[model samples]
Target: MKIISFGVNNFRGITGGLENNTIEFNNSNTIFLLGQNNVGKSSFLKAYEFFYKNTSAAVEDIYRMNPENVIEFELVLQLDEFDFQKDSIANKKEGLKKWLNPDNLLKIKRVLKPKIGAKISFEKTENYTWDYEQNGWVAKNYGGIGLDTVFQAALPTPIFIKAMPTEAEGEAIINEILKQKANANLEDKDRLELKEAQAKIQELQDKLYNPESIQSYKEEVNKYFQSLFPNTKIELSEKDKTKWTENSIGKSFAIHFEQNNNGEKDETIPTSHERIGHGAVRSAIFSLLLMKDVAEEFERVDNRKDYIVLFEEPELFLHPKLMKQLRTLIYKVSETDTPYQVLCASHSPQMIDITKEKSSLVRMTKHNEGTRLFQINDEFLKDSKEIKTKEELKQEMNEILRFNPFICESFYADEVVLIEGPTEEIILRGYFNEVQIDKDIFIVNCGTVNNIPFFQKIFSRFNIKYHVICDSDAAEVKELDNYGLIPFETGIQKSIYQQLKSDYEKVDYSVGLFHVNVPTFEPSHQQESIKDNLKYSNNYLASDGKPYNENLYWKDVLKPNLNSEEINTVPIVKFLKNIVDHN
Candidate 1:
């Protein structure tokens, strides 16, 4: 079973004020949570952990703000034949299989309303009724095994890899696997009869420590010792009595890292998991998770185990190059024969595969108003296949990856300014600097006028209000690249901003999309609205065979003139400022 959708209410940050929140996931794809800090991204992942890891979480734990308050959380899962076949899953399959919705999906709900107020548990969501006083769900099928038995026993165990102590996590993971192996060996009577072996050891001890010829030696010796010294009487103890048990052997193992570089007979240097670098440790842990999940899936005879790995800020301590490698690894592992799902809560674009269709992306945002989430529909993903063929898409992705740090920088910024081509990105960055506006506004190169929607969708998904500046490539429309066209969309909008505002109910796009009222962005841009003299200055500055720097024109321009409305650059600055101010 894989998560199809998750809903939470009266949980932290999301509901100390907000009303309700739900994040629906796409199956068989990477589900990315894109948002700024303090949003429901982490809370959403925690819901998965709570439901799977701590099914019996206390009432006060989940609804910590108030134990008496009602709390509601729901999970919709896409099930398969294997889900019903497993014993633990089979037990819980009662009353649930019949409850599968029209889509053949299972919706399990946890609700404590009107004061059941004890602990977290599984209850059938089938016949639940709303209680106005408690303002939460009241499950009709109370105190039952609707979907309880499949908690990691039959369902995919949810694992977390946050931005802390990754090496130690790896160590813990390795130790647990080793213990599981040891316990299996101790319990498998067909492989090694532990009880019989314990009996044989006892016989051997009798021969060595107790003289079998003198049958009553232990009793006779104890009696004599008791007479000699009442409290100091001795008894023969078997040393290996507990050796063959699972717990005894499981506790005996420990992992150590040691190395000796010199060829000379130097003492080996021993080290703990702490010595490893953060990136190395994170990579190691991630690799181990991938390997183990795949192995677990394949090794299972009856039910294939599906594992969902959660990573929060996966790019925390890694370089841009490493981020790309790690992102690629996530997709590769999910695509393997192993049944796996990867969820990432990230603020770094490098950690996300942007080229992948939006169905894989979920945008989360929080504010005093409330937290809202939006995910792309399957229609957009299907439409993209026609827009770019497989080979072309791969090449585009590779090129975008080359500038991972620069491309993904918008994710970290407070405001995003998405413009067509590198020229606009450079110009806007220079323009922002020239005016000396100290803002966390990042300019993203959208590459083409047609591609404006592709990026705007991403920005809006993360709840980042973005202002788009695109060239009116009308004259070159036939020759221009086609990207902004989605399936549900009939044709290109005369004003993409108007279209965007209509398309999404979330963002107010009145000032978001700004199409330069000109034919093109180069000479037309220099001639029209702004009449930028920098274009002339750039030509004069260029002398060598080398190309002119896009940012070079602004070098000699003073800040005061750029700020002055009388100056030529004011229109551009004001336009950029309005985008920021409005948001």
Candidate 2:
């Protein structure tokens, strides 16, 4: 079963309606939740944990701690033919026939209500599965199966990792994973070895057991039992079937660390779990998970399809290098043979990869109504198919990330400025930093003017307020050494400018689009003295057959022209300020 999406309402910090609170997996295995602090990103992960656990809700679990608020979670899962196979469902199709929709999708809703009074407790939360025939939710009860059992079989178990993990938490996770590995089916060779070992152990137990003494003890225990209940009797037996199973042996598993000091063979030290640092323990837990998934890639042990990892701040307690490695492992688990889906709430930009096709980026913000989720690729290239193919856009975005992963910082911003290159970015950033002291506007360098529309498509889809600034080059171009004429009405520059203009005009939200008017940024300034300095810089650099340094252009030419007193009055500075102020 694949989780398509889940919705939450009145759960903890999330009080939005079901429609606004919905998070779509979008057929992606890796979903990232990115936002500022207290935007309810962790709340979403906790809500999933709540759904899978189906435990009683504390009074604070309700939105605003209101008794009238009902915490609701709805999960939409897609089931395949394999899910209908007998191995998955004991009674096969008959057992799940009632819960499946026409498309074989299952929608399950869990609602929790708080009971008010001095002795506060929660009312029993019922599991309601969508009934295809009734076209609404009905209590899902398969024969005498418990609600938790039904869900355990139907959905993947959610492994929720909360932030601020301790050594004990890491040890607990390791223990559970080891148990899971032990319970999984073994190889034929290993199975044979274990069976032989078990048989020998049982033989020794049988030889040690005294049947006569055992009978005497059984009679003594049964004498008291018969006085009250004559029909019931107790028998103590040595059973081979229940002894030395893989899980039983697995319980003996323990993790230890050895350290060598100064490369001395004899000067080795051992460390216990409690001795390890929090970061090391957390990294060890993630490393074990990665190793398990990698092992499954070569040899799958279990047929379980429902394993969703609800991670909070996966980048916590790790170095930058390890954070990147963790991000890679996250992508690996999602792409590996194992049916593992990871939903992460992360604060690190390194944890995000907009290049990955099987990844979704969501940003959450606290609103008056509640927390609102903004999925960056919600519509999935809904607006820019004509400009670039999906693959082309992804490749471009990947290249952009390769050069500058910090571009992801834009996703966390409330407003963003998309510029053509570093020159525009530097100028605008300096101006915004000095003048717009209170506003936080993120400026992104799109490599070139051609790449701005691709980013525009992304920001627009997320409904993010953004501004675009680029040089509207003259309708002409120099290819190699040959100069060619590009018609103003039918040219790439015209096309891009027109697209930006149309976007700026049609969008009801705040947006700004500005063009340099001249061929490039340096000439956009009208000051003759600054123009003279630019000319001198270009001429000096021309002797070495090199272009003038962009940094020099800013420091020597631009900054000198506009001092602190005249900065806001300058045309370019005023224009840059206007872009951000438009919000």
Candidate 3:
């Protein structure tokens, strides 16, 4: 049971409009939710909880309180027969098969129906729909299964890690693990006896404490008190009568862990490390969730597919090393053979596992109208997958990150500008600091002239506002065509510009030439043309009456140009200013 996509309205902060509205999965299992503060990254996950996991939440609990408000949501699921086997009702398989169309997909919706505004006393209904290749969407007979059963069949057990985590969230999991480990200490016969006694004890415990079981008892007590009192009624609850804590399985079992006293002598301790920090507790829950068996357990129970987890800021309180480790583990778990998927809300770039063939990061933001979610993989980088293999793209991105981690800013920036090489990047970065006030724009060094086109292809594919600034080196391009037309670097630029023009009309570009006869960043003297890559240039005489080298020329030539009030007067920097300003 996996939720492919969902739509919610008038629930919590998601008011449902052109801004905050439907979320389409478009077929991704591991998803990363990215956003700024209060942009609905957390709210979206909470909405999923109420819509899918909180089966007992009433209309009053879910309906957003506002003028003329009503709550409704729909989920589209990619169904599988393997999960349908969990429905032990002999006829459940029949119903599952009947609902599963040729595409193996099912659509369901929850609505409090009554057109009247502010109406809470309306009929709640869950509708199921299927589609045919020719006839389009058709209603299905999910009537046989209750709304609760439909939910079970559609999605997995949702494990959510709240934005504000506490030790309480992980205590139960720890207790269960300790209890299971403790069973190893018992003899076979003793274990069996304990199991039987536990079952009997739980049975009695349920009878005394279960809300349904004690419902009549509470009503009778209220009636008895009401007879003695005129306008008062009794409210009763059932809890442990034992004043002292009972010696239950949990109390009897405990795990003694060795404590490293701040890297000093080790000591065996029985207490928890919860008081130490929030990071430890958050890591504990996350590590347990990544356990192999725990992941496998998320698979369909009794053959019915179901299980999922929502993690908000899983990287909180951890160092970069741990964050990377957790990120890798999450990638492994989400890719397992089980439908157990991991979707996390994260602000840390380290939480992103972009090495996967498929990109899973989804960017979210808030607007005046509502919140918006942009699926980066399906919307922008989808075409790149077809042109380049996953390995190929991963290698390129890894290499990009190796030298300049700042290049990764393109993943989050609203607009991206690609520069040809380090010289251009440095020059522009310095000038940008002096002029560009907008922090949302990014500038990346493309490493080489050839890399500009490659980077532009990706940005264009992603629908990002992209522009390029490259060195023309046109003055030195002496290669001649059959018509005696000299076109070398200029030819390459024309081809790239044409492609950019075709990809986006009115192409935005800025090309700069070295001092008329100069070529690359390393401009040597005219007599030493072959030494253009070297630091020293004989053309400009230094104060010591020596020809200037790359080092001397930078201080003598570059620094002054950069520090000038008219920094934008420089050809390349000026072009960059135009592209960035327009954007």
Candidate 4:
């Protein structure tokens, strides 16, 4: 079974109405949540665990408080043929009902605090209802199996093995097993059983003491140790026969060390497992648990649809190189035929790079208003044009847009008006309304003024005509000039001011002019407008009552320049109309 979508409300930092946060899994068999630290990346993972397993472990603290702070998580699971076959055989049903039964589908949910318990609830697609007053889902099947049984059947069982076992523990277990298997010239049946038991004990001891033998069992373990402690070396030796000390019989293990520079031998070195660092210990434990889980799955003939794995900072206590390797490991595990779905939260950039495309990344950020979840969308990549290869493009687009969530693709517009910020974008949009211009012209704020060059490049590359309005700052002017764009400097109201600077002489034809300091004239004040057409706003005056100004001055400007029919109406409208006419 595969989860298609999930919804949550009043869950921890998440409150208000249903966020409708969903994840869709492809046949590619992977899903990743990519975001920076503390962005509810971990919270989403916990939510998945809480919903599907009904396990209070992930949400127990939140549940202890107000019962009304209830979190509702719903998953749409796609039932495969194996699930249908198993359910049909178990329930002994026939026809469409047998094939389409809710019980056969994996639908898991949990309500925190309100009802702190974990169990399978029969709320499959076929039986779903929009009625909110149901209080709870009608349980067609209740408490079928514990999460452990299902988890063990699906995910790798988590085994956290530290370094090799201590000599005392190894010896004690070995002696006990040896004593149990010991007998004098036993019969064939007893001898065979004893040998089998002896072999099992030896294997266990060998894993603890013999590095080479353990490598035979798990190659990853050896590789991990080598990468972690490059200077130290380990080997297993047989028990010394002549000097048979009582303390050393079952614990007959020795570690030999050689100095990095010299050939000097250290025969009495400490255990390699003990000498390894804490990070190495953690990695070893994680690897053992993962291996055990994989092995158990092979032992049972469970269908792939029933598996789910949850990881929290899998990169913790790991080196950058190892963290990268861990990512590859995650991908490898996900690619298996078993229905292995992995949800992990990580702060490392390496982790983000691993599954950049095949995941749902929610960026949680704080603003003056409050906390908000900004789902990373395709708009983030609107300024980027570096993607070349198909795979790179797919991953880049997927990473940013969440697969075209915007829905509406084509916007009918001839000329594009690009602004610097959201506020300006909104104000201009409203201004265009006052002017009664057709709304079809695309007016977009490329997020920041710095991105003007990028936006221009993209539009030019696509053969789209566009106009950009930006601040008169040196950097903004330089950027626009670099892109061969005309700058629309805000605020001058006299033709003399335009001719005062030679910079405007270069691009006078293409450039548009306006001033931040200039005052506007009403139709009734035509005589007054002629007398003081160059007057400035009080807000633009310095402490000396003179107009505060910038370096570059406009060469040609007029009163209410932007609205005048000869200047604003003809030039601006013609520039816009030309795009469609020429195209």
Each candidate: RMSD: 12.9, 12.4, 12.5, 16.8
Q: Pick the candidate with the highest TM-score.
A: 2
Root-mean-square deviation of Cα positions for candidate 1 versus the true structure, in angstroms: 12.9
Q: Model 3: how far is 457 from its true place, Å?
A: 5.1
- TM-score: model 1 vs. ground truth: 0.71
| Top lDDT prediction, candidate number | 2
Clashing pairs in 3: 1-305, 83-304, 83-305, 156-306, 156-307, 157-307, 535-550, 536-549
On a 0 to 100 scale, what is the lDDT of residue 320 in model 1? 76
Give stretches of model 4 more than 4 Å off.
Answer: 6-8, 11-14, 17-39, 51-53, 56-60, 84-108, 112-139, 142-217, 220-275, 289-300, 303-307, 336-339, 354-360, 365-583
Q: What local distance difference test score does each model get?
A: 0.54, 0.63, 0.53, 0.40
Ten contiguous residues minimizing lDDT sum, candidate 4? 546-555
Evaluated at residue 49, the lDDT of candidate 2 is: 71
Query: Candidate 1: lDDT over CA atoms?
Result: 0.54
Q: How many angstroms is residue 267 displaced in model 3 relative to the true structure, after the best TM-score fit?
A: 4.7
Better of 2 and 4 by lDDT: 2
lDDT of model 3 at residue 225? 27
Off by over 4 Å in 2: 86-88, 118-121, 139-148, 186-252, 260-270, 292-305, 377-394, 432-436, 475-509, 512-519, 527-550, 560-569
Error of 3 at 7 (Å): 4.2
